[model samples]
Target: MASFLSAFSMFGMSSLGYRTGFGALFVLSVNLVPLGALWYYMHRKTFVLGRARSWMSMGMPFGERYGNGMRAVIPVVVLLASIPYLVAQVQGIGLMVEALSEKAIPYHMGMFFVPVFISLYLIMGGMKGAAWVNTVQGIFFSIMVFILFFAVMAKNGGFAPTMQMVFDTHPELFQLGAKGGKLWSYPMVFGFAAAMCLGCICFPQPYMHAYSSRTVKGFKTMLLSFGGICLVIITMPTLVGIAATVIVPGLKGVQADKVYGIVASMALPDWLAALAVAGGFTAAMSTVNGLVFGNATNLANDLLKLMVPHVGQKGLVSAARWSVAVIMAICVVIAWNPNTPVAELSVLAFGTVAVTIFPLWGAYFWKRSTAAGAMASTIVGFGINIVMFIWGGKNMVLFPSAKLFQLNGFLAAFIAAGLVFFIVCLVTKPGKIEQKSLALFFHPALDGKLDHNLVDRSENEYVKV
Candidate 1:
């Protein structure tokens, strides 16, 4: 669960930091509003437990339940989408190392080192080891952020003076683009929020954490604490990024991803600079390990089993370890090329989750949501995003235009899938056996009891077991 929190915190800091400095209050609200709702929903409804049970009962604890067809669709999309996401984290480590060491350590070396460290703990300890490390790293990251924020503000004449300076220098930065400003347009801001909320729900790292927690209560506690911590980490860095825009003033040629490193190296002392470097590594490793583990599990449990059901548990675990190594190697190769910006790369993962899995899972639990609806929504939503990505790459249209069209993709997919599921359920109707199976899986009264019968039978037999 801590690893899950770190994943959200890392991306939240990287992508949302740009909007932070100008309108601290407004940006904070924008980021926290959806988080607050998620937290509340988790608390009041025991959302994690319900979700976990649903997945597990469906013979797909790792997301195999939407049928073989759906399973085939989701895991491949995740693996593909996650490549750029993982590479961006690798790039972050390299960029930080270069900024702090004055190019003493080559960028390739830093990139290589991150994945090696991640693979070590992940291969040795699996999810358990990753969570323990993430907990410690998350604590260190939080402290470093507060220290950096206070130091930067003190050096720049405190909060009030800093804001005044920012306003004088880059007044447009403060506007939310809703009211004639440009840092974030109204549609973009809302789209981002929607994507993030859906991403949190569907993301593999968070789902893994939800599964690993000792209890439902523990998971809920982690979510609330982690959400609060995420808000602080993100807001502070954004402020720092804005301050850099003012202080550095000559950071034009450099990439936006380098904003944090540049500010940390130039503004802070040697020790503080080292701490910032450590903090960045903490963020990078925490996210990397989680993603590696997520992909590994999907391979071990979903893809591998589908092809080779006879593979023993020990063999499965070994395969998962190797999968992590292979995935890490691929990510390293991609990171070296560096085709995408850090912000864009991170958003790509979120966008994929929002469009693909969110609607599918949403409808699975909602009475109004049908399997067909979920499936349709996923196909259309993902297709639209792909087209938009291609178009955007060619400089034919901006993301906002792509998103406007993508919205229809999501809507059409959701409606189409939902309608199909409803129609199917009504027309070919479930037999008593099927109803019994659905009731046992979906509304089983037992809190923690294992439905051994459900797990023991073959996939087809279990549907009526």
Candidate 2:
């Protein structure tokens, strides 16, 4: 459920769809493919294996292919990727709060206040607290927003009239090429879709939550429900964008980000608008708590374990709680500026983590995968992604209409990562294959005949067996 929210910020999605038109829909559709792959992969793991595959304790699963260096590197990437994603959620709260309060609260205060509230519960209950909060928030977010979505439609004389207005006003939104001043190209649309899809599953927060599931049956059920929720959440915002284009035309530049706020404030009653704000608040808060929990635990368990092994469980838990507060503070500081668009910042976070996909796939499925290949891929993919981002703000081109480098950072980073991972793996020495771990991936289901050795296996420490 948290992963569902993480994939698309509420205001961010509406703005992107409003700004880019049908191109946003293409990205949203393709984004679900990776979740299906994630479900299949996790479902195949031995039920007992679920408990041990966290970023901190990933040695058993990744040790055979990635070795210690890459295993250690995963959490760092997760931590970095998580921070920006957290900031996007914090920024979402700021946008909604400012909108809800008529700009009296201000963005920085809203960002600061939301995280403090979130940190209190996160420090108190850890993952259990996050899960309960997610359940309540997820329900509130979907129901109240669904109400707002339909109300917005009705106010504009229903979906048909709203869309007809958009088609008549912004015809390029429905067409393929750069009609109606649309910026997204065909390749750009599909490429970003692939990146979003791949990035969604590779993100560590969702990956971290996978370990908490108790049964494969439960996991599959959750995946199904998640897919349904994603469709509903994504669809609502896209429709909201289209409706906003009709209701409040000429929302240009950063003003597009205010579509959700504008719509809720204009169409809904006072109580309904307040409910919409609460729903958006819950959505952002739930996601932020989950990310802080994941990053804090990674620091306490994965990074510090090698440096401070003397810290016992109680000490580690204390460290985790402290890390939560510290990380939330850092996010508030970063969010104060709010430089990038919420959706773009979210895709940036996803792209940063998507680079790991090639190495991860190689580790899980390929017998000849090498540690050198995985490490090289991780470094190059992320390095190029960062460089391209600094150099090219959005289009990855210095000047507008520069045809030489038209690719978005997300697609470019993903392709570069995959190519490097493949070529390096082929040339480097084949990594040692742990038959014990290999057996689980190679024969995940075991045709319903379970192997107690694989199912019951547990690792107390990181050992390069």
Candidate 3:
């Protein structure tokens, strides 16, 4: 849960819920299927060796088959993905604090100086420290939000009554694809659903978390537990957003981002509400810290290390620290004057990282997967995403007759990348696979059984061309 769920998720879910109540659940339930399926495959890829194999080591698999191409491109995409999320977190803090303080604390005040704290902890303590902070924050936020949900439920005369009231007054909020709804309309749903699904599937942090499992059984347990926890965490805020519709009503535009804090203040006691506020801050902080460190490692291990392959561990550490400062500074500056809503920012992050999906998965499944195709897919996907983000904002493509049938940047970019990936793979010649190139991913034990030991297996691995 701590791996990816953050203020980005909480604020985004609430805003979605506020706009369209049960529509938020509809989106999550639809998107989470792909996210969970991909996560499972990614888990098998990393843990097949019976050890954690992502993070600093994840590049090894791609590096072996795809060589320096993947090492060069993946880091940039990962960096791009992290920025939107970092901006979302800072935006979350600013929105929540401003709402909680009743605007005595300005929005910028909440955003300002956050990067400083992230830089300090990440530069000094690294990802371990970030993970610890995320764990602690995730636990606290999870508990408080669960308690806060029922509190709001009781105060609002229970879930069914709230729904009855809303239906009586504003039925559009719960309609999944109502035409006149501000955000829950079909066009909007298509875009956000793509964003949420890709975002959930492609974020780098969860892949790293997959590496922590020491055993297959333990890994399954972790995934199952994570799935359940995600349902709870996601449900609480979504319902809170629904409850906000009744309690506060009439919030328009980006104002819906503050629904979480407003509802907490209305439902909980003064002391608990304050704790809830603190929980919100911690949620934002945890995600920021994690992204900061994640970006730092991406710079040091994947990008920088390739350029200077001989750098020792000490030099890498220094480079990662420097990367933290630089990256955090950039994110803070952008967050300071964000033009995008927190929900949109989070969606953009998902679309950015998702560019790598074809480049990554093709290596394991497709025999014709080539480095050129991988690199081209990365560039094409990223380029299309940038184009659509800037030029395709609220612009729909295809099925010109009906607005509801159009596709958004997130889905369009992903599809374009995959198409290019397949074309490039067919046109280009693939490198040798029957060697030590994929010993780790294609262990000999994988033939009919499982083995934890490192097997010198490559000649017969993934060779069906």
What lDDT tens digits, residue by residue, belong to model 2 across residues 351-460? 77788877767755676777888889988888887787687665561112334355566666777888988898888876454334465445443344333444444322
Cα lDDT of model 3 by residue, 408-444, tens digit: 6667778889999999988988776413445545544
- Per-prediction TM-score to the true structure, in the order listed: 0.82, 0.89, 0.89
Off by over 4 Å in 2: 46-48, 52-60, 63-65, 178-181, 397-406, 431-465
Answer with 2 or 3, whichever has the higher TM-score.
Answer: 3
Q: Over all chains combined, what TM-score does candidate 3 have?
A: 0.89
Summing lDDT over every window of 10 consecutive residues in candidate 3, give the lowest-scoring window: 395-404
For lDDT, the strongest prediction is: 3
Reference-based lDDT, residue 109, model 1:
85
Q: What is the Å distance of residue 268 in model 2 from its true position?
A: 1.2
